[model samples]
Target: MTASYGSAEYQGYLRNDAVTIAEVLRLDGYRTLMSGKWHVGGSYKPRESDLWTPGDLAHPTPRQRGFDKFFGTLDGSGSFFFPHYIGEDDCQIAVETDDFYMTDAITDKAVDMIEESVADEKPFFLYLAYTAPHWPLHAKEEDIAKYQGMYRNGWDTLRTSRHEEMLGKNILEGNWEISPRDPTVHSWADEKNRDWEDSRMATYAAMVDCMDQGIGRVMAKLKQLGVDKDTLILFLSDNGGCAEFLAEEGWVESYPDISPEGKKIVQGNIPNLAPGSGKTFQSYEAPWSNVSNAPFRMHKSWVHEGGISTPLIAHWPNGIAQSAIVHTARHVSDIMPTILDVSGASYPKDFDGVGIQNLDGESMFGVFLNGHGEREQPIFWEHEGNCAMREGNWKLVREFGRDWELYNMAFDRTELHNLRDKDQNRAERMIKEYDAWAKKTGVVDWAVICAHPAMDWVKPAKPEI
Candidate 1:
């Protein structure tokens, strides 16, 4: 959804014509508040004004995207400590304290927004996007200390262990094999600088742990306000683990080597430099990311299972059935329709005299209650040159500039086996469907974008997928 849809021009900014869920909810008398990672639209620096407010009220801002209140950054990533581009409604907010952590700050603001909404006696829709566990690998020392030495065994063994655990818990069927270690990743035994690699993954875990702690705080706040059971809380990750290396060519040149807090930002795939320091902008890289998306091939950006698959958690004691796990495939787009269905909100046929697009997703409230359901349309994905389509038990996928590969998702969800050669006609049929969909959606070919000069620095085999 964040990608360049329809055309390359649609890539970065959230188009003005879009009608967001929050907008519809506002019509139904709900207050919408968002805190954290507002990458959908807007500029961090307002040219004409020096006001420090919640969000920019003007063009291409989250406030324009139906969020009445916004507190976050405009970009995908940044220093988690003293993030340079934080915003409050209509203006930029300067981080003045040395102890500022982005995850904690986002949560704190969300809690305050919730309290204010309660005091105002208004129902609220809060989009609290925690930019935790993302790149730049920044985590508190105490959080980093908890996972010290935990990843010493390396990604190869860790992937296997995680797969085993998933199998034991019936989270995955026994028919699948843990896909082999990512081709670009070295075997743990063959890896030199083992201690440093271990530290990198430890820091990544620490970021996730710290995020969990913050989530606990938010949940505690909800409970304290007596809204725990009444409020429906849904949590999800946008994509699978990221394998992109930041030391690629032109990256350091593009981003500065100093943070807003005056700390020297370390850049590169340095072996000895420990991550989780506020001064580093390093990624955990492919090997560990491979472990994070265990049993699935590839990482974020690719059209692979590991790239797009995410665990969705929904908690509503008064509404949803408890302890139910739905294995049915769902897309992120389904979130809007589900919320609208629950709230009895209507998607406008026309807004401001222009026809609005119909929601792409179906209401998933049934899945919450019945623990199983089916989507009417086949799932489709395209990023870079990678593309995939899933329909029932069959999936057809291909890497950019590569031949199509087919798999029976029911039997080979790990994508370890290719059944394309065995069923030529089925593959051809699905390819035809994908082609029609692409044409209708005005999808720009990857060949067009990949050749652009801006993509010159992207390394081919990293986990950036």
Candidate 2:
């Protein structure tokens, strides 16, 4: 249901071991179902032959995690056309047809489950996680074609354009200036491989477009089942845009050759080998990713506002009011409490004789009714020592191994100004607060954790080619 980093090479396996919200809802008599990416468990090197043959169907799968039904892949990214680890419930599905695209297929399975739930006349909780717009950006050609020449102006213009649009639409809350283009990226006009670079962005957009189309189909089905008004639909991204410039040659050798149909699979960011095909594995890289997180700094993995920010869309006609953008900071942890509050489900003191951990989330269910609310506690983040804490409008943030920067987000949520030097008092208070939170949460030293034996995946920088 959630797209978690399952690889022990980064975060440890404990991420997948916790009780899921789906399991809790199931205990409340809701029929739990899930489709699409389940990257929280299992690990396997991708291979075309594994499509029909089935790869590592490891323990602690969706079924074990409490979903009654699940169908999807187990890895972070795979061929949308011919995925390597496709599964239906506990069984691995054979990829016999090249016509399959993950966005459509994942939706197809969800619709099937919805129909079954309707036939049984049971209220259901379905978790549909789409790994769209992720790396190894493989999208359908038709979808890709829709975006042809769409990014001709390149990331420079796109970033500024999107920032202006967000400001015009009031999607932004304050006078947050768009952060300058990442210095690492060159000007659009200076880029030599314009066509290839543009094509990569086009493909990435196609993936998002395809996912939107699938979501529309799912919504239509919900309406048809007379559940649209009552069913709560919340959409959110797992993280900000990914800026990890994964050179294909750096990792492609780990995958299996000879695709499912016995064709030699072409992989890498080869300039001539245009992406969007099943045989090719490619990433749009950081230029477009910088645009994706426009007006904000950094990308996924950092504690910058861009890395952790995503808009949450809540739709429930029966229980909530019309569309309204809420600016209150919310964390992913708030989701479970929100669902439980709306469903009138209680957080159990103990489950199956083991004591349950008390919830650390405040429900945003009130926001649905009133369009906005506030949390008493400050939101905190710590990923790989890239840490942040936001209390009201004041924000304290720092990249891994960098000095902390404080910002008064009331007038600058884009984090353009550093108030740490001017207001040392506020910075010290926030840092002290963050230290307490870190200690209470058992956050260990990053250096020690990174040095662990499990982190063997941290390879040295070398020319992959």
Candidate 3:
């Protein structure tokens, strides 16, 4: 009915939470399938982004969790080709197909699972998280070819254009101001290394476009299986477009990984050295990443809106409300319970002696029954330097330990107006609420988390704050 998922540490919780979801769903005899990246444990290599085999399956892997099937990569970064991803019992396909991209691979697996379920006449749950357009951005030759010079206009133009498109599509509200291009990403025309800059964004867009095609493939399969109408598909990014290329050179022509044990590993170096070939070594770089997170400030790690915000599209012909509606109040944690509600699963109090955490989410499944109703639950998020609490339209957010900023989300979606000083009493109340939530949720304050852990790759770079 429902599922838990996320990046690294978050995924760890998701795995544990999914177990909670599955045991409950089993009471109703429903099937759950997970197909995507599961980056939750210690990386197998010295580097964080490396993708390879015999990954450290030390902790609870997807197999141990509630998922009957799992398909995904271990580390975050990888060459698109011959990625370190592997499928679970059913997911581990024995394909010797040559030159198959990871995005296509996962989609194919999902389609296979769906077809299998249809044959078995089983009502199923599927988590299809595309690892594309993330890092090590690589795409099919034709996909990369489609955007030859599409990004020559630079991020400023691209971000503005995409923002306009989102608004035109009614995907964005009338009040939000498109955030400016990130200062870190230089304009292509002004960039000294024009070839590299041009290739970077072209690669990023190609990755996204390629994934879209892969989604089309999955949809086609669903239609063929005649489950297109009955199935529920939730499409969204895990977080806002990431901008984590800490090193100036995001691409190395070759991705080099050396294990803590000193074993040198290159991500599908063969057949990938060629520019157009989708391989694991390359990343889309920063300029286009700026566009991927349109009209939002900051990237993945920051607690800012841009870092945490994502466009969520819920579609199910049988279950979804017909009217196109936007539910701005939902958070990632809410997804699990919502799915559970649809499949009619109960949340078990205890499973295998491991007591499950209470559901931090409420089911908006009622939305399908009674239009998109108001969320009775408040939205809360904390990760890295970002911390936010949403009670109705009022939101309180702070970047790291900096002073809290207040915004009336209903009026100022971009959060350009800071009402902290203007509304001191409200700000104080919100801060107190956030402090309580942070303590309750095990949020490791970035100031403390990074300091003792040597958070960055470059060690001992202490936080000035």
Candidate 4:
């Protein structure tokens, strides 16, 4: 429902009326299970009295929605070591071990859940929503050690190297060029505290590395269960690298003051003290995030390619004919329709006496089989006042309170060139299309959303929708 953190409209949670893919699968006789982050629901606390009631608008837990089993944190981001609001089914759980890492713990539960589902002799759908690679950048010592000093060459070199690697592997197609480095970022050679900067990226890499290892463990479990070939596994990130820094005043109040081991949590990007420890809370910050979204412009929250573009990898040994990179532009909404198409489930018009919203995305099953999919309508996106619309190769995008810029994504996916002035008619037509879509989707103006009384605590540099 496009809910922002601490917003009064949604109270930072998903609305209850929205039908989830898990619910549909459950109705189709699949044992739905989930582990890891569950940030869509109301804030879950350790206290039983604080739990959400049935009538609450933003309090539908995963179990309540459709999952037969659920285990994860209710909040979006938290300390990996001593998480703030962890839940198992309906109740909260405490961190029982000194060395308990959130990523590993999530993997453990996922493996266990798979075993239980298999033992019950029912087909299962496991949603392993790992909260790795998000802020407070925390990772295990071993994972951090592997990436130590790896980023000493800095983000600039990493960008060039990664872009070349992607091109060589044919992952990028059609005359795509890397966008220039963000102007606000300093050249690595001119930067002071190179060691600290390198450490930030290293810690971030370690978090991802740990998550990858956990994924491998899940794959191994699938193989052991003799369902590796039959099961369909899709992997994708929620968004691009985040550029948000944990430097806001009184930010520590949002998190636990102390760790589970009674250690005081040291917060913010302190230059001297490196990240990756339970006691420290830090973010990779913008400079490294620019590297994370290498060859693309901008970070998360923007409608730019860098913020919205992410690879959707599908692995189904039995279903897919061959491994190939598909350059089709697909939205996150398409995942549900694709799942339903693959599983032979029907999308109901009504569920539990409530009308279901019409699907905004088309099934991507054709793309999976033939590496191509057709869309009847253009894709539209609006996040934090940054709006964009894409129809075939043409794209119209604009930052808040700015003139629209156009690009032919076929030749300039990085959006380095602007065509709005050259093709005014096309730009105007796309703008009208975007406006119509926005109005139909009930998209509120950025200024109006930011001015709401609920956002008084938020002091953003720009209006956040």
Candidate 5:
């Protein structure tokens, strides 16, 4: 499941035995609904009959997992204009109009569900997972026009400006330095095809801007329903900005070859063809991605701060009495426990004769209420063999097959200096701790996994960590 792409077998989908937060809430008399991306399920293609069927245990749909109603694409990334694998509950659906946009449709469905839940007079839990700013770089013409020349200054200036803004807002510690620009990237002044580069980033910004508009609509709906003050809305990204290019062979195969209106799809990062159109499929590659993850080294798929760090914005006018910035480190695993704590719902040890795995995360509800909380254990991460561990202010991290590097996060959260040689004992202890945690969590070696016959699709070339 940790692999980049899902398989056809049971390994591709979320396990049926596992319990979801939605299931816990539904059991406690809350209506659960979800919209947008649901990539944890099986590999689904609208034309394929041989793939996982409805109600199949090996690749269960969102409705089967715990949601009372579900509407979203099963696959990870696709065209915003015409998604490849959209579904309603357990049934596959098609884009009925040429003007259809994925983000707007998702927001509309979420609003409808909220209104229906209010009509029924039942408390509802809605999981609005937007897939904007992911890939294909598709956006509406109006949205694209808003940011057409905004990024002409290039990533260099953008990164520096953004870093300074973060410092001004106190989002980052004062002592933590801004990381150096990625060595792979060249100076903006020396780059050719400046207009094309600007368009790529502009399209990306447009996608994000459109997503923000959708969120605003959702907030308006909540206010209309008179539940805006009581509802707890949590917003967070799954990862940092992505640097992956879409020029690989077979990349276009995953998307539609033609538009719904019978236009040929222009796929890949085609410099000549400007992005943000329904027919064009492109990504805002590494240069702009570097700016997106500004002041932080690396991008998504790595365990570095740039890859893993994301702001968790908790908005609850009724629950969170006062506004205050909390710098406590937390993981996605803590979300379930935090919801349980806030809602007064008990996590069942045994659900319908199946024993559930014990939760690894502690509740962050205390942090929400008191603006501070202490973690009982150190946080650990291992993705594609890029490993890291954080114990209070100290952090140990390394790329795949590289020696461990140590940093004191309190002073150097940007990881500018490696203190591995200065503090060998602490480094050794944390390495051992990470190893123990990985072993207990059943984390397989990334290299070993890549060598397996089933993973032949994975390119031999290692991605930059």
Candidate 6:
């Protein structure tokens, strides 16, 4: 809901994007289940370690977020061996294992939830938001082993390979050109040695491979439960694969680094020393992050297509004739109405005695079923002041407090060309509309929005009784 691999434990500072969706679905009479990171809003203080201790889930959890059940951590990063989380009913599992990785555990629990939901013969709205490929670069030995030397080619090579594969798969068309590497990243040749680069990518690839396997497992469960064909599953990342500064937070390693011959080589997640764990902090760094986005201009936290444009794969045998038809018309907020359409549920004017905020998205059910769109609503995003608004083929995007640039999305999906001067009229109109919407939404200034300071402004005023 929020993003894959995001800390499920919502902190006090964040917003409950998931809760908003789940609550609306509940009004539709569907049982909701969420597994994975739910970084909505709550206490994520590291000192309060029980924040993730699974056995003692307190109030303001997924249940409060609209999920009937949840299994996830409060913090975004932690060790796999001593993974911490609170189960359903805020019951602290406090489960720790040398073998259990959080990604696998989250998926397994999701699968189990599906089984129970199916057995009960109730339609379930399941959100399996994963934390794969997130920071800390932790992975199981076997998963890590599978990726040994796989990233030796480094980000430069892997980025090229993924780009080519996506092309063959028609994930990309010939229309878009791959962007150059980010200037901030030191070129591979510029790096002092290859180990830091290779290990960083190796860990990341492991994260991706491990996530793919878990996804396959979840798909298997849906197929097993006889809902694979009917259930609508939309797979997407919250944002682009994160290239956040890893040095500051440190790597949360699950396994010690080993040589290709299976001998311990480098300590994992440690910063400045080797790219490794526990005491050491690390990230895949900037250059490779540029590669991760590929074809797109920037990594996460930026408003460019690379940072915001993600692959949206929708699968529903009963609803879609296109098995893997890629749709560029939808946005993250579109999910709310899409689910309602498929399930024939109605959004509540109010939930739990509280008036509801009007939804920012409309159902995309028609596009899936008719092979065309029924509606095209303006979509807006303002994460950390990297703001963007899309209305049909025209979009207004900008870095907060920076100049706003316009683009023709249909022709410029890669955003290589700017239409600021060429389409001043269109830009002005969209900017006007954006301003109006911002006012309507109680939009904060760029500085506050970017920092994500407490935005208690009412999206919808309280409804009269």
Model 4's lDDT to the true fold?
A: 0.82
- What TM-scores do the predictions have? 0.93, 0.92, 0.84, 0.94, 0.95, 0.83
- Count backbone clashes in candidate 2: 0
List the candidate 6 regions with Cα displacement exceeding 4 Å: 1-19, 27-29, 50-59, 248-281, 448-465
Please identify model 1 stretches exceeding 4 Å from their true place: 1-11, 42-59, 453-465
Which 10-residue window of candidate 3 scores lowest in summed lDDT?
1-10
* lDDT for residue 217 in candidate 3, whole number 0-100: 89
Q: Give the Cα lDDT of each candidate.
A: 0.80, 0.80, 0.65, 0.82, 0.82, 0.66
Worst 10 residues of 6 by lDDT: 456-465
lDDT of 6: 0.66
Ranking by lDDT: 5, 4, 1, 2, 6, 3
Candidate 5 clashes: the total is: 0
Model 4 reaches what TM-score against the true structure? 0.94
The residue pairs found clashing in candidate 1 are: 53-88, 53-89, 54-88, 54-89, 55-88, 55-89, 55-90, 56-90, 244-464, 302-465
4 or 5, greater by TM-score: 5
lDDT by residue (1-465, candidate 4, tens digit) is 324544344356655456899999999999999999877775543233244352255577888788999888776778898886678998877778778899998999999999998888989999999999998889988888898999999888988898898889888877588888887777888878888888888889999999999999999999999989999999999988888767534433456658656788887777868888888888887788888897899999888898998999999998887778878788888989999999998888888898877866888888778866667678999987899998988889988888889999889999999999999999999989999998887777888877766555444332122
lDDT of 1 by residue, 117-156 (tens): 9889898999989888888888999989999898888888
Error of 3 at 21 (Å): 3.5
Which of 2 and 3 is the better model by lDDT?
Answer: 2
Instruction: List, in order, the clash count of every candidate structure.
Output: 10, 0, 9, 0, 0, 35
C-alpha RMSD for every candidate: 3.2, 3.3, 5.4, 2.9, 2.5, 7.8
Question: In model 2, which regions exceed 4 Å deviation?
Answer: 1-11, 14-17, 47-58, 458-465
lDDT of the structure predicted as candidate 3: 0.65
